[model samples]
Target chain A: MSDEDFQEPEVLLPLDAWHRAHGARMVPFAGYSMPIQYEGIIAEHLWTRESAGLFDVSHMGQLLVSGEGADAALEALLPGDIKGLREGRMRYSLLLSDEGGILDDLMVTRRADDFYLVVNGATKIDDIAHIHEHLPEELTLNHMDEQALLALQGPKAVDALARLVPGVEALSFMTAGAFAIAGVPAWISRSGYTGEDGFEISIPAEAAEQVATLLADQPEVKPIGLGARDSLRLEAGLPLYGHDLDPETTPISADLGFAISKRRREEGGFPGAQRILAERAAGSAFKRVGLIIEGRQPVREGAVVQPDGKITSGGFSPSLQKPIAMAYVPAVSAVPGSTIAIEQRGKIFTGTVTPMPFLPHRYHRQGSSK
Target chain B: MSLYFTKDHEWISVEGTSATVGITDYAQSQLGDVVFVEVPAAGTAVEKGKEAAVVESVKAASDVYAPVSGEVIEGNAALEADPALVNTAPEGEGWFFKLTLSNPSELDGLMDADAYKTFVDGL
Candidate 1:
């Protein structure tokens, strides 16, 4: 690559050089030069599972939906009942187009009288523009341009985080709260992409380095790159914006109908509500599912999904200790235990569709007995 | 026994009719994480400069070429489940296979350790 190869996007991380100095294999991701792996991806992936992994995710868009009428303004673009979301509570919702296809899935949280939104790194620009164009003028969309996002994830994440930012344990899953991390005012959310117990910390851009350094000093934390992040998310059965989803994929077909509230499905007010509601009631043509490959040979993106279905993302999964993949297969092939074939280097290999999170998800579900 | 390397970053240690093969440290570094290794089964014949095995990282896959023509008498099945062995000790436990050299003269075509070091430095 050349600088010409990438049309630079906004939101670069504060620790770009630090990542390179540590022998990080850098790649262009979400408009930033970020480490894809350090000390190799497999090691980082396994380390994250067995312990904790720290990820620099500042390139993602963080914005505050505030001012009068913000809640109603946002409700027009998404199907989720944002008005019902209480302060500090978070909900996973989709940004939909007129046809009910998904533009992106984002987290919407309620503040005292405002909404805080976090959107995917790759689609944040479009997400912002979509909000600006759709929402009423009384509402204001303020993008927090100078902020850094860090994710500390895995079984040991809470212990490591609690040591630095006290009272975080009380926040619970799908919750966000304002707190001071090492004297720096920040927002901490008990949410992440790794399907492990984790926290996503958003700190001021100037304070990012100090916070990252503080976390790096912990014995349980190591800087994980995009390479391990990909495998971890793949193993977790989470979707990557451009790969697992796009404007063409509706939430129903993507198996994300759960994000739409029951009231929203019945009332039918959001974009593409007709198509989405019909799909929800009638089922979709194809669905996204996980695959456990027969051998050690890991398939990759665009490796023709044989017999017609195609894989959007595929790689060696560190969590499962085997190769796994996510693909859009025909509805018949999307069921768990359905046999399929993926072609690599002109040869077809056998695989079976398996429920996602190749490893059981360890999210801190609320109201569970300890 | 002296170790020699090919330009493709494969290293071979030859003592006589037998040789051990693995990837060079530089190759492993470029590969990032070693997740899976697919080696030719034991008793398989491999031609020089041909794809005899594969090593995969989270990001991509690479073909490991045979530096010398030979019959693979032993493949490292341990790598199938524990590919990290290659990252941990590429020269020792990470060795991919043991080959019975079909043509001893092929050894002369490989670069010695010193030459290989120079080759890697330039890369």
Candidate 2:
């Protein structure tokens, strides 16, 4: 019953005391004691969709990759267009095995001097080991363990954060830059996992509480927890590394072909490019698809997808007011409008294979946020 | 008629042989924003401390257990359409089912209202 990774005892983040003081219901997750909910998941989720929701995601791995040929070294280990990543822009990419299966998904930013990588918390150690083994000898990878990460996300996020850190509104979606928040030095990216207009701030551990308290005091910001973070990302149709994605899953099968940049597809030297690009050209055996459950009852993860595999992730979607899920099914059964049957707890629940992002993304671009 | 409590946080109001069963308000508050409820069909037999229903929130799913052995005569069909009843009125309109008690003596093993309050407080 303990789903914990057990790699180590539960650890606390820099914001642990801060979360505890704010009535967070802490749960052990990915080897850290994390807040699963404060007021409630549904309320916080809805709040993010309307206003700004602050999230403490310091558990994710933050690294600085530098030295000559770091971009090419990273390209050899990943499928992203790293060499071409312009300064201050961030790209979502996947770390892949030689066979083209996903090692992990990550966000790689091209800073002025080096690359800034943010990877999943649970797989951070393994990711570091993998990178160290494969990265060129000239490159150096440093784990920025002394930093804490926070995401201020939603429609009102921009205005509220702009008040504290001037000129942050100038950055567009998927952009990264340095900013001073309440006079605290921080690295901020105009990006987030919630598919809303937001900013991800990386600040020193010592200044985390002060910076977090400043943001929390904002009229538009309410402290959100991992529970709402999951639901919010689910509505955005993003996959969690340990759940919807894993080592056994390939980028094509995971519907992450976008990470395989255009130039990489043509250049064809990245890890598992042969197998991955082939699967892309001639579809994978199974595909990750979204589901719309027929009724009120939820069909959770591990439910058998009739004539195929299992539901990788599922739950009630507060945004849609119905059950939504992501699952792997045979390529033949992956059509957008096709209805599939899932059996859980001795009963069958009807679900339609709908296109992902059950809700529309409201990202802020340089031109428009609406 | 008397209300008895189960360790699993269920309450059963016994009137002669028929008992009304539902979760305590505390359980619903902990569950938060109940989106759906799945109850055992009427006419099914359930044993004490056995799974009888499931309540799901956006965050997680929990199994609601039967507090006493009985034949289920009715399920709260209203919950099928409005699961938030569990959060709004956990002990009243949110009642999960009605069952005819098979062993009336099982009620003695449960706590009284005051004891149930103390038990919940400990948690």
Candidate 3:
């Protein structure tokens, strides 16, 4: 169905015209019209793994948190140590419900001046409401709906991005900085969901078309659609919000404890901190793990994991040349090398729990200062 | 030399005892970026209108059925590494398999290229 058919009000990207012109098959996603594929999903998936793929992810929400009590205000809602984040650095963190379950995961960047946040497009409204309701009166959150986001991902991404934005090459993985791309002001971050060295460029919605066209001209870059985006992220061991991470899954159980800072864990102020921290110390009942399907048959989402588990996300991984999936199973059955069976269409497909990132991540880490 | 198509979108070009099989161009276009093709084993007896192989795209998976009863004599193995061949030349180099026809009259029950085109157009 078209996005206009959605019950919730929908938002279209500034590059919607460009997307349609480039032969993208538009589909309704998270209350927006998005390109599900262009040439084809498998080709785009392989292109991103072997080279670079460009994605128009402008639908994601960007917010600016500022004011005198910003850090303390943020600390009240998130499990991250926002006060300790160094300026110009970015931290991946999560928003939690009062019951201690994860509401959404997001990236919080400490700008030279204010705290900039990038959250999932689908949960942005709820996230904003959650923050506004919980934050102290002294702090204010400004939703930057005027901006657009693009993810340039894969091996050739860094070099291509470096040419477009000169100073971006200096940033390490998970780092963020402001720069001008093709003379257009933009925010560039050295992070992506495709398990590759890439950049997430945030630019004014007005400049999005120019930037997208300029990048599409590069021989290494191809217009990737959401169909490939999902496959690439799955291969990278990244979780999709509604499928992999939900209200019922805590950060600890999702193996996202790394996002929770040490200071926050010790002080215990954030929502569900007690349950999360305790789960960390004692371990969780179930854990998310990657699966390498034995045969060519794919195990799709909602497929049952027997003798006790469930497939959270699944698809054919072009990079691995096999069907891969992520599943939540008993902690004992979630270990790497654990044999499991997934039921798909009345037949059972044998799979094994493998270490996440069926493919190795190629993040650009900075050299040690020691 | 008459062309025939199965409802599952597989097309076959029959030349007496042997037939060339492949997915229709419309089928490949619909699949978009074929990633894998599970080719049926050569010499296997496949029943007409039964599932014989699979074609997987990035977004979903689909089964390829035998357009007519036959003994598969040959199957394309190149698709294992480069499934894009189907997208590039679905009716030519992208042929899926070759079958030794067991029931030549079964071809009469299949759709002709013109009828197949109309069937897909209506879809």
| Best-performing candidate as measured by DockQ | 2
Candidate 3 Cα misplacement greater than 4 A, ranges:
A1-10, A368-370, B4-22, B37-53, B63-89, B92-111, B118-123
Better of 1 and 2 by DockQ: 2
Candidate 2 true-interface contact recovery: 0.59
Rank by TM-score, highest first: 2, 1, 3
Tens digits of per-residue lDDT for model 1, A1-370: 0011344445457888778777776777877778888876777888888788999998889988888778777778998988788889999999999988889989999988679899998898899999999978777888998988999998888888889988887777899899999999989998999888889999998888789888878889888988888888898889888888889999988989988888788788889999999988888988888899888778887877767777888988766667788888888788899899889887787889999778888887677432
lDDT of 3 by residue, B41-72 (tens): 89989988787888877677788888899999
Off by over 4 Å in 2: A1-9
lDDT of 2 by residue, A185-298 (tens): 999999999989899999999999999999999999999999999989988999999889998999999999998899999999988899988899999999999999998878
Better of 2 and 3 by TM-score: 2
Instruction: List each candidate's DockQ score.
Output: 0.35, 0.52, 0.28
Tens-digit lDDT track of model 1 for B1-123: 768899988999998899999998888877767888888888999999899898887778889999999999899888977898888889889999999999988888999999989987875
Model 3 TM-score (2 dp): 0.85
Most accurate candidate by TM-score = 2
RMSD of each: 3.6, 2.1, 4.2
lDDT of each: 0.85, 0.91, 0.87
